[model samples]
Structures are given as structure tokens and as C-alpha cells.
Target: MDTTQRALAVGVGAALLQALMLIAFAWPAANIAPRDLPIAVTGPQADLVVGQLAERSPGAFDVSRPADEAAARAAIEDRDVYGAIVTGDGPPRVLIASAASPAVAQQLTQIGQQLSGGPAARVDDVVAADSDDPRGTAFGAMVLPLALSGIAAGVLLGLLIPTIGGKALGLATFGVVGGLLSMEVIQGWMSLVPGPYLVLAAVAGLVSFAVSGAVVGLSAAIGRAGIGIAALTMLLVGNPFSAATSAPELLPKPWGAIGQLLPPGAAASLLRSVAFFDGAGASGPLAVLVIWAVAALTLLGVGALRTRPANEPATAAPIPVTTG
Candidate 1:
């Protein structure tokens, strides 16, 4: 095709990409609602409250009957449930882990009010988010930038450093520096997270490594196209479905599960675990990040094996000699 035809094609392609991006981002936000959100309930009204919840929202909550208020509190602290309801004796009380998810906490508080047959119900935030970020807005907004940082690091390394070994080293360095910087800003400057300084930094670093490694690995394996693949996966699929702003249950089914598999989602969960839940629910997300990092390294190794270095001296063809 001529230049004008190519320009037109490019314009149309850009428009289509814009449309897809809009749908990817907006669809999840528009359709967000609880889907089997875990919660605990106790006391004499446990069965009745569970019944009401099921009747009202059908399949919205996955209710667990904890033995008592203490058990429910433990569940919330351990990251097993987002919230709990204690019904019996006095007015119903709601236990929430705002650090887990402020959106879920508000939802639980509302539910408690409804169950109480009063305008307000007693509410307690068993594990509250940091005071500076009470609503978790900062925390939620953090994942995208971190993901982008990793992507940028990988892209730069891929372009600037031609050697696979050099790229690997760059990715590791970026991960470490990026993690420390992110932690300093979010924890020290903003006080958004209340976790241990070094631990949070380490977690942040791991996330960075996982994301950058994936991008670098894919680029090494598939040339420039790998960059686009990694960016789109992290941005369109991983960021929106990450559930960073809300609980995984709040996101649409399958997508939420899918997000957890991606670096962004896994990062969010792992960060939250270390920051608020004392690493109670850390294993799964930690494993996910490890797997991603490993896969990226493996891809890098494959690329190294398959790709010929541009700087390598060409092998000399065997000189054929004819004797006269």
C-alpha cells in the first residue's frame, strides 16, 4: 500500500484500539458488584441474617458461620473474610477490615444497619487502613503506576541493552530500585501503607521484578511485538481486573480470577497482605509473582538460545582448496 493508504489504515487501527481500551476499563467499573464475597456471621440471628442476605442479593455473599464475634474478628484479621456481622443480644454489630477493602466495609456497614432495623448499627473496623489513606484511594491508585514503571523499565532495558544477560541484570536492578523508591513514596512520604518498612519494600521490589521480567522476557522471545503484548496484558487485562480499588469479589466473575493470575493483581494482593493482614493471605499471591518471574526468566533463556547476537562475528565458511 502507498503512504496515504497506510496512514488511513493506521488511523483506523488507532481508533479501534481506543474503543477497545475504553471498553476494557469502563466495563469492569460499570459492572462491579459482589460475587460470592466472603463474610462471617454469628449469634442467634446468624441463620436469619444469612437468609436475608441471600434473599436480598442472591449469590452476592459467601457466608461463613463463625462461632462468635471473636472468631469473626479473627477471620477478618487473617484475611479470610472482608467483614462480619454479629447479631444477638444488643443491636447488631458489624466488623469490617477496611484495610482489606473500604468498599466492602461500607457495604457491610450498610448491611448491618439494615439488619439492625435501625438507622445505624454499631460498626468496628478491625483492621483499618492507614489514617492517611482511610478510604484506600491512594492504595488503589498505586498499582497502575507501579505496573507502568515496570513496563517502562523493561522497555528501556530491552531497547538500550542488546545483550540478554545485560537485560536480565538491568531488570533486577530496576526491580530493586523501583521497589525501594515506591515504598519510600507511599509509605514514608504519603504514609499510605502501615506495614513494616523493609518488608513492604521487599514485596514492592518483587512485584517490580515480576512485571519487568515478564516484559523483558516477552520482548526477548518475540522481538518488538513482545513489548506491545506485555503492555496490553498489564494495562488492559491486569490493571483493570486487579481489584486494587476493591475486593476481588466486587469484580465480575472469571475476570477477577483472571486478574489474580496477572502480575498487577497478584502484586496488589501481595502488597495488601504484607501491609495490612500481616501476610496472612500472602502465599497465593507470592506464589503467583514467583511463577511469573520464573516464566519470564525461562523466556529470556529461550530467547538467548534461539536468537543470534547482532554483534557476533560471522562464522567463516570453510575455505575449499583445489589442488592443481
Candidate 2:
């Protein structure tokens, strides 16, 4: 076979290998489930109740028998457990930490009520959410800002890369423009996701800026590797486990537990608090994002400094000697 034919065959094989690897990584990441989330059970019949819940739910819940209600509340407050169930005279009460995810709390309430054989279950939101917030909507707003910011960072990186500057810039521009346009289409035409337009726009802008800055900063620091890492961290790992499409409570255990830490997950929760939940309990996620953005920018700045040309004075020519 000709050398050209061999080269083509090798290139095709490499491309196929890359495609398969991506698919393999994405598949399991998408379907992660929580295995052993810490949970507390309290009250007179706590033992029986915990057992029932464990037996009935099986892999869905792991029950922990806390000493008392105060202990259970403390567990939740400290983020030791995802939730707690408290049994009372009339019906079982499920106490949830609102800071975790309001939707999950509500679902637990419903589940407790069903278990109690027609008696209405009482819900005590130990960490109360802002009253104005709606359920199942926090994830989108929280994720929007970070996702946009990451995109911006990626674009900047592309522009600065020595060989791919023009192409990277073009792609980055398209992503930013396309992302904004998508928001418009979603709000105006589809109406599938609802919120205040002005607020949504603001969120979109902030997220896009932050994310773009991060991507650019990363690329500046490490060149091509930085871009790949940013994409992996921000887009691939961050988006699927984002908790936007499904609240953490609704998701299986594994995905639910780590969702809060991912960039998209953090931003989505914060946005949900602002838009649907009255911004009652979003400080944690907001803080996480601020730290990430600041850190990335710092790295970018240092990288830029290192790339600057060094200052050096030109040496003067030696005095010419007279010929004998």
C-alpha cells in the first residue's frame, strides 16, 4: 500500500478511538446514582420507621438512627445527611434542610404522608427556603451563569492559542452569540422555561462572562491542555450532573450527592434561589463560583506576566582601534 493510504488509515483509527473514549466517559457519568447518603431518623418509633423505609425503598435511601430531633437537625445543618424523618403521634413528619434542595424536602414529605396510611404528613423545613421560590426551577438559573462564563473563557483561550487563534476566536464568538440567541428563543418562542426576561438576561450575561474568562485564563496558563481540561471540567462533567434537568432529590443518589459541587450545579442552584425561590438560600453556590472565577483569573494573570517580553539594554559597540 502507498504511504498516503497508510497515513489515512492511521488517522481514521485514531479518530475512532477518541470518539469511543468520549462516549465511554459520558455514558456512566450521565447515569450516576447516590449509594449511601447519610440520613437521620428520630422519634418514638424511629427504629420501626427507619426499617420500613429502608426495606421499602431499598437502594434509594439509607437510614441513620440519630439520637434525637435536635441531633438530626444538627446532622442536616452540618450537611452530614441529605434528609431526616421524624415520627410523631398523628403522622410521621419529614424534616428537610431547605438549603439542600427544597424539591427533595417536598418529595420526602409526600412519601411520609403516604406511609402514614391516610393521615396528612407535616413538613418542617428546618432550613426554610425563601417563600417566593418555586420548586424544580432553581437548577436552570444557577447553572446558566457558570456555563456562560466557561464558554467565554474557552473563546478567549482559542483566540490566544498560537496556531488556532482565528478558528478558535470564530468558534468562541459563535458559541457566545448562539447561547444568547438560544435564551431568547427559549423565552420568547418556546416558553418551555419561564422566568423574568430581564433577570434571565442578566444571569445569562454574568454566566457567559465568568465562564469565558475562566476558559481563556486556563488556555493562557497551559495552552492546548488548558482548553481540554476546561471543557472536561466545565462542560462535560459539570453539565450532565448539573441537577438542572432533575433536582438532586429526583436524581439517583450518586449524581445527587456531588451535584452541588459541580460548577453548573452550584450556579443552577443559586439561580433557582434567585428566580424561583426568592434568593433565600443560595449563598453557598454563589460563593463556590466566585472562588472559582477569581482563582482562574489569578492564574491567567500570572501566565500573562510570564509570557511578557523581558527588558534588556542593548550593548554599545566597542570603540574602533586606529589602523597602524
Candidate 3:
């Protein structure tokens, strides 16, 4: 009823929403399942491996064939395939890209051992995660900071600038700088994500720009409520859906599909492409980020137009007509 009461209610609601967000993400994550995982196979026993997988797990794999070991390695490195099974005269060798998806890598190795003569098979990780980060924990950790940085840039800039042009300029600048700085800290200082410095930095910048633009646009359109909504969407919903820890197919039906459609998921996918996959699977994610950035910019433009004062001439002050 009162101002203080309304403010207190709003605060309480935000806190409650945050709790729900944690549950929304944690619940699905606690229950993990691998579905339609992509993999590559080649050589003599390739057909046998595929057949056995079909028999054993039904819909476990989306298998492809590479020409040779070299091609298989390439597929794994570029993330075109998460793991590759190369079958030959001796025990089958499983090549995995642990850096891309550590969980999938472990699964493939176990599968290889079973498929091979119990203890004879070898599991080789071509693009292994760094020793310090054996399971690519750093990959998952990177997304949180990136999302926060974007939100910070958006909220701060949106408050400081009244015009759309000013806000847009501020957000863009922050995206580029924040992106480069974050990469330098993560990769240069910490060696978390190792790749071509320039390319990685560029991808980071693009992601920052998209996230920042989205937040700023949303806030401009709906004031403080916009910021809260953006946080709920990106930080809570988007982060869990992002296939950072595992492949999209590994997640449940609607969730995997939903994550790809949002900014956080799209950005994480783009980062993986640049860092390890040589940008092989970047097109879809890159397109997604582009669309998000464009839409946010449009929202900002609309907000700016609405802020302009009305063109109708002001009415003159009421005449003091006194009947004496």
C-alpha cells in the first residue's frame, strides 16, 4: 500500500526469484543423461562398432565416418565430433577431445574399453584439457564471469547515458574492452583457454557486445524491472542450458534446444569453436549472437524514439479572467 512496503515487496520478490533460478538450474544438472551424442568412426571394425552401439543403447549415438585416423583426429579437434573410435587389427583406439567436453570424453573411453577386448583398448585424448584442469572445469567457469561482465556494462552504461546513441556507444566500448581484458586474465594470466590470442579475444568481445546490448536494451525499455528480467533469463535460465559441461544432446529434450536459442548458450558455443574447434561449428552460434545483438539494438532504438518530447505546442497558462 505504501512506498516503503512496495519497495520491500519488490526486494523480497527478487530474492525469491533468485532462489528459484538456482533450483531451476541445479535440478536438471543433478540428473544427467547422454542422448544422441555425436561421434566418429573409421577403419575395419567401424561398422561393427556402430552396430553394437545401436544394439546396446538404441539412440545413444549420432555416428559419422572419417576417412582415416588423421581425419578422425581432425573431426575431434574441430569439435565436429566429440570423440572418435578408430578400429583396426589390434584393439580399437578411442580419440577424445577432453577440452571440448570432458564428460563425453570419459564416456567414449569407457565405451572403447568395453568394445575392445576388456583391457586391451587404448583411450587417447588428442586435445586433452590442461593438466591443472583435467576435466575442463575452467571452461564451465568462464561463462559466469562473461555474463556478469556484460550485465555490469549494460546496467552502468544505461544509467549514465540518457540518449540511445550514448548508451549504445558506452555498451559497445565496454564489450570490446571487457572482452579483451577478461580473455587476457583467463588465458594470458591463468592459461584457462588457450588458443590464437586474437581470435579468442575477438570472440570474447563479440559475446560481451551481444550480452551488454541485450541488457541495456531491455533496461531502457522497462526500467529497473528490465534488468531483473534480463538477469533471470541470462544468468539463471541461460547458463544452465548452455552446453558448457556437456554437449547439447546430453541435456534433456526442450532444455538443450532452449539453451541454444539464448545468448549465454550461443556465446559459450562460439567460444568453444574459436578456442579448440578452429571455428568449424561456429556458423549457427555466430548467427545466433548476431541476431541477439541486432534485436537488442532495435529495442534501444525504440526506447530512444519514445523518450522524445511530444511535438504538440504547450497550452498557455490559464487566463486570470475575473468578473468584477
- Highest-lDDT candidate: 1
Which portions of model 3 show Cα errors greater than 4 Å?
2-19, 117-120, 310-324
**Candidate 1's residue-wise lDDT over 1-324, tens digit each?**
999999999999999999999998899999889999999999998888889999999999999999999999999989999999998898889999999999899999999998888999999999999898999999999999999998888888878888899988998888788889999999999888987999999888988998888889999998889988998899899999999998789998899999999999999999999998889999999999999999989999988986766656999999999999
Name the candidate, 2 or 3, with the larger lDDT value.
3
Clashes counted in candidate 1 amount to 0
Model 1 poorest ten-residue lDDT run: 303-312
* Between candidates 1 and 3, the TM-score winner: 1
Residue 173, candidate 2: Cα error in Å is 14
Provide the TM-score for each candidate, comma-separated.
0.96, 0.59, 0.87
Off by over 4 Å in 2: 1-44, 56-86, 89-110, 117-149, 160-206, 247-259, 275-281, 310-324
Compute the lDDT of residue 251 as modeled in candidate 3. 85
lDDT of 3 by residue, 166-199 (tens): 9888877886787788889888888877678888
lDDT of each: 0.91, 0.63, 0.83
**lDDT agreement of model 3 with the native:** 0.83
